[model samples]
Target: MLSITGAVANSNGQKVFKTLKNEELHCSEAEMKAHLANLYEQQKGKCAITGIAMHLHGQDDCDSDMLVSPDRIDSYGHYSIGNVQFVCRFVNFWKMAQDNNRFAELLDRVVANRVADTV
Candidate 1:
């Protein structure tokens, strides 16, 4: 015999679940929602590294780089409540590209590059 169950999801919850699954993360939909709410309270939508406000898909203009996303405090760590927080997608990708601790130096270089591009 087989048993089937149904889960009800609002659009936001569905979005969270999809993101987690796509990232191959271990968080449940409920956990992801709770963590995101807490992060919004604590960070007020600012990227932890760049201090710029994140743009969420439904709420703001959806720039892939500026979109809000979960970032693990430790690169290899699991996505537990204390280990994860929301950040700008750009910062998350930039941090993942190299070492997390070098964000300051990388930000400096990024600024210089922007300045050079305009010259």
Candidate 2:
């Protein structure tokens, strides 16, 4: 994808947007899995928020449950917190439909619960 940086003058004296620069964030599957493992372990085999066990499938193989749009994600993993949760599929599914406020509320609730449980 291209990113804009500065403005340039056009023939009609109107400012035309131009591409400033571009680079790719390459992440191989193996590296991704490693990162995911770290996140999974950090959360103690459960979601960072919900504290539910993460599931991939019958085989239980999921390196990262990536958000379709990175922009939509929260402030982890650049909105791509890899394997950062262990929620049931249903909860994960719910994430997709939640608005920003609702998502924040859910995460807050889960984190609070986890903290309380620990105490």
Candidate 3:
């Protein structure tokens, strides 16, 4: 049986375990952390979709929108190394709540609205 106490002891470990449980995916804590680190390097501490600065627990001001969470680029994909990326918690939740094409369209609309306001 999985140990909840140990899983919740570390923030990253907790996230890793939760993802495994919620998604019915399987991966080691070390592997998940490594994947998260890789995505952090690739994204340079920004949301994968929004490109906004991330709010890490110890590194930045905490915000609901900036909470980092693992995302599967292909929703049906396994929680493997290359398939996972880190995204803002809110953005990930929003994306999962809609169809991918619709989500993309809405994101484009939001970006366009922001750009229009700047003009």
lDDT of 3 by residue, 23-72 (tens): 64568879778777877998998877777877877764689778888788
- Candidate 2, superposed: residue stretches over 4 Å from native: 1-26, 54-72, 75-86, 97-101, 106-119
Clashing pairs in 3: none
| Candidate that scores best on lDDT | 3
Error of 1 at 11 (Å): 40
In the range 11-47, model 1's lDDT, one tens digit per residue, is: 3354353333233357787987887798887998898
- Where does candidate 3 stray beyond 4 Å? 1-22, 97-102, 114-119
lDDT of 2 by residue, 1-119 (tens): 12332332225576668864332334665765676667656756664445555545344465445221122233223323332344445555667635545776987898899999999
Clashes of 3: 0
lDDT of 2: 0.51
Would you estimate the TM-scores of all the predictions? Answer: 0.61, 0.40, 0.64
Off by over 4 Å in 1: 1-29, 97-99, 112-119
Best by TM-score: 3
lDDT of each: 0.74, 0.51, 0.76
